[model samples]
Target chain A: MPLPPSPPRLSIGAVAGKTVPRLADLPWLIGYAAAFAAAHQAAAGWGGQGFYSLLYPAAGVRLALLWSRGPRLTLAVMATELIVQTIAGIIVPGQAGWLTAANGVARPALTYGIVVWLVRHVAARSQSSLGVAPMPLGLAAVTAPVAATMAALPWTLFSPELTGVSGLRQTVASLTGFVVGDLLGVLLIAPPLLWVVHAWQYRPRALHRPTLRQLAGLAEAAVVLGAAIAASTLLAEIGLGVPAAPALLAVAWIGLRFGRTAGWCAIVIVAAIVLPFTATDLPVAERLALHMSLASIVVVGYLAGSFADAQARAQSDLSRRDRMLFQAERLKTLRAMSVAVIHEISQPLSTLAIEAKHLHEITVAADPDIAQTAALIDRKAAALSTLVRRLRRFGGRSVDEPSALPLSALVETVTALTRAEARAARVVVEVSPIDPDLVVFGQEIELAQAVVNLVRNAVQACDGRVALSAHQNDDRVVVMVANRCPDRREARPGMGVGALVARAIVEAHGGTVERVTHADGTICATLSLPRPGAET
Target chain B: MTLPANQPDRAAVYVVDDDHDLGAAVARLLCRHGHAAEPFLDPVMLLSVYAEAPALCIVTDIMMGDLDGFGFADRVRMIDPAVAIVFMTAWPTTANAVDSVRRYGGLDYLEKPLDETRLLSAVDEGVAWSRRQRSIRARTAALSARERQVFDLLVQGHSNKAVADILGLSPKTVEDHRAAIVAKTGTNGLAQLIALAR
Candidate 1:
């Protein structure tokens, strides 16, 4: 009989034409068909067609194909099944050609089609990517009986030997036998097939070659698997109550120890070796009991794989948070550093802005002093670039050896450097005659930084006058910078960085600097040091 | 070391900053704008000339050593109480600066790198403000002893009754003194008269 009008037909030929590379797809299709034929031929070799015992791998492969290839591959399944059964010559012994095809190919393929649809409905929410993760057990458990019952209709119709079992009781019994057999086949074969296909699809690259430790772990797992199977068989033969103990322990050990890949590998190895052994001469209840034992092991493997996935995710998440925190801390430090740098550089930038504005003013003035304005810009620019250079060489200054220097010349030189600033501010610059006999031993450049910081601050702090004086008393040379205080209300010193930096430099050079506020509110900063060959 | 007593004294800018070059540059810009400007590296110099009221507009920098811009301005208020002030700072003005400007009656608070147009505009407004203040001070100076007393007490936030109680006069007499104070100062209302007193 013809199939009742089916829903949307999904053909592998149509799918392959569109999605797959034709060149690659041709080889894959041929291989799928060969594997499909080979599983059937193997089953028949184990037992004749009349006695449909356990181990029907063709059903498992059919379900796998239906899932991985999608419903579009329905025609591929029917066509492949029809050809394989005809070649086996056991589809029907003396029936019409169409009758044989329907009974052999259409019957099993349609029943499996219904099973695939039922499993898809039940496992739709928890869908797996077929080979990559374990197929939901509910898919096979719910699909088995429906498939077995559907198979009985066309099955008894085509086979003349079972024509007497068309009664409802006979059909139900046949359905039961088919369910037990198909369920065993699917449980035993489907998981291992998916594991192999998944492994092949995602084979590791050459760059990720396993380490010796990983190889030793794999070897250890192999020894454990072999021992488990051997122990279970021995236990079953002796009629001990705990035949599944070894299987359950090995499943948990491999699953938890090495994660999903190793867990699936352990499951496949156990299924391949132990499944066929349980198929011989066993009563229905005993056979069913053995299938249940294997089913429980597969579920344990699934549980262990899930635990491994969760831990791996959590570990990666923790590392990501740590990386983000480190980056945030680095950014905060950079922001603080930039604020300090801006503070230092702002004086020069402000000077530039002022000078540029003044240049325009000078051009418009009657008898404008162009030369004076140009000189001012050039001087300010020089000061700015010098500051930049010093910043760049902050930690890398060449160590200079100290030598004796003329104290009078040093004072005169430092005063000359500050004269332009004093002239612009209209501040009086008074230098008491330096003592010709007073000299100190030190690095001139290092001492210059100390002197300039103090002198500049004095000029900035005085009203109309700043004075520089050098004197010698009792083997000690002293340089004094004095400024008339701006405010007489307790002469509060301005909080500029130059004073602090000057203090640090003077202290570092084995010299002492002092600040004093006179009763009249005139401020004095003095630097004193031991003259060469004289004690402090 | 002194300019003629009559030379642009009423249209002058006093540019005080700790950075001597910056002070000179600012003063030079004001001179180009036709205002006689004196550059002071130290804010203390303002104290010396503040009693003389030499500059109408004082453009100063904050963060000066010895005396900060606010301290200098406050002292300026003591000597020449009506000078217009413009503060230039390298850092962004904080909330404290806003409060200082409001409390001290400063004309403007500016940040550096100084925009030339904004600086020129602020100084021009400050010059105008200082002129207005000088005229108001002159008018207030013309008030009689009784009117001055009433104005001072009223501007100090004392009511007419409170001022009468303090000075042992009737509230009606205090109100008459207040009216005379407002008219002499050329103020439209008590608030304007009080601002003039300030």
Candidate 2:
């Protein structure tokens, strides 16, 4: 039986190709044909044409293909089924004729085509990616009965004479066999096949490599699968009541603990051990009872796996976001502290340079020893100043360190750093006195680099003056940088890389940078960042 | 260290800076170069004692806690117009250099870790310029009020008759006053008188 389409979340692990089969699709089709012939040969002894077997894994192959490759391949699917059956000698035109062969082809084709279409329809309405997530048991339960009825319809209506049923009661009994076989096939076969398709398509790179814990979980589930198989087979052979009980309990545990992939594997393993018993000579009621018990196990296993997959995905997403936020925060704090410290030391450094030079001049003529010492001081101070200047240059740093940085200190440091540049450009820089307590959370060095770039650009962009100021509005701090461009023709259409860099930095901190050019020749750039403790 | 003997004609120079150690060091360097140099930590303190005994030149820091170097120069200019001002700053730029000369009447603007050669040369030139200015002012100060008016007109290339008409005096009296202006100011001719005024 074909598995019901689950939500796209679990199914998205595979690359779903919507186009019809090309040369690339031949391998999967050939593989499916081989599985179909093998399954047919295995169930040949069960009843008439092996159609009454407890599990139809071929139904799963059809569903998996239709789910991933889309419904356009239904014709190709019917053709392949006819070819496989003809080669296996199940369809001999000389004996049952072509009509029976046509009915046989039409049965699974119509049944599984509707099954895939219905699954895609439900997945579409829920806005899910097709075949990405594991098939949920709820969708399976809904599609299984429809698949059973559809699979049985072609045989009941077109080939009743071939079925050897004379009346309504016998016909209904024959129909029940087809329904139970197809239903049991879908429940048992489709989920594991979908998972195999997912794993194969996403192998090596696209699929997330399983971590150690996940591998360990799979190993644990494997052990439980082994125990369940051994116990179920021993119990059934001894004619013990509730032979599937241990297997059902083990499947539920695997589904909830190891997620859908492992859960489906366990279910398939358990089904393989128990399903062949239907071929043995037994009472019809007892065979039906065994099929029902296996069906219940399939449903329980899928439901638990679906729940586990959803929980794991939600947890992984939350932690990843948290890690990014922490890194950004740490980066901003360290940057701010370093910038402020550099600005403070710059004045004393200038004094050191002057004093050292003076000392050298005073001692040079009279005392050779003192003169050499003074020269050393002068040289070291000059080297230190060069290092400081290089450090003060705008260079991008790691964005992981962060802290709450005062807006007042940030603006002051940047203004001081750019003072000589502004003077060289013949522009006067006016910083509006900011409230000392106003602070924003971000990487300090990056924010300073952004502000410095803006100020230097403003100086170069304007005629005479650049004004920088900041103010608090609720939980946000907005820093405004405006420059006077007396000649409107000189105003640039864009602030270029400076504004782009600032925008990227501010936006990273969940803020915005807005720039406006006025007709009066004043260009204003405003940076709005979330104040400390105000970010949601 | 023993004090070097002071030159009798040493130029009186003042160094004003916010950094006390830097200011003192610059002053000592200036003194070693044979100038009666003194250091002032604050521009305000420098200004308070400036009027009593004015220096020939002043070297001041541009970025200061109280009055900036420009403001200080302006005040000093009001007290003694001949005092040469040289501006210095930790941060130097083309705009500051232009403003130092054009707006603040500075002889030069220098950046710190001071070049001793440039500082000494600037101070020497400023002292010579200040001396010339003082000499001219003293010679011009000797003229009587009436002769001073006549001298001003003559310096403008006005004829003796035109000077008399503008001053509302007779041509004989105006010519007599011009001679008195030349005698009192020690100017040999109209060209010398005009050169002195400039």
Q: Which number leads on lDDT?
A: 2
Interface RMSD after interface superposition, each candidate: 10.6, 8.1
* lDDT by residue (tens digit), candidate 1, A76-162: 667667776667775664565556445546566666755666555544443233312234333443365356556665656566454
| Candidate 1: residue A16 Cα off by (Å) | 15
DockQ (C-alpha based) per candidate is 0.18, 0.11
Give the alpha carbon lDDT tens digit for every residue of A175-278 in model 2. Answer: 55655666656656666676576577556466578899988887888788778777876776788765778888899999888777677778777666666666
- DockQ metric, candidate 1: 0.18
- Which regions of candidate 2 fall more than 4 Å away from where they truly are? A1-20, A30-52, A67-75, A82-240, A306-310, A365-372, A396-536, B1-198
Worst lDDT window (10 residues) for model 1 chain A?
Answer: A1-10
User: What local lDDT score does residue A213 receive in model 1, on the 0 to 100 scale?
Assistant: 91
The lDDT per prediction is: 0.67, 0.73
Q: What is the lDDT of residue A303 in candidate 1?
A: 53
How accurately is candidate 2 docked according to DockQ?
Answer: 0.11
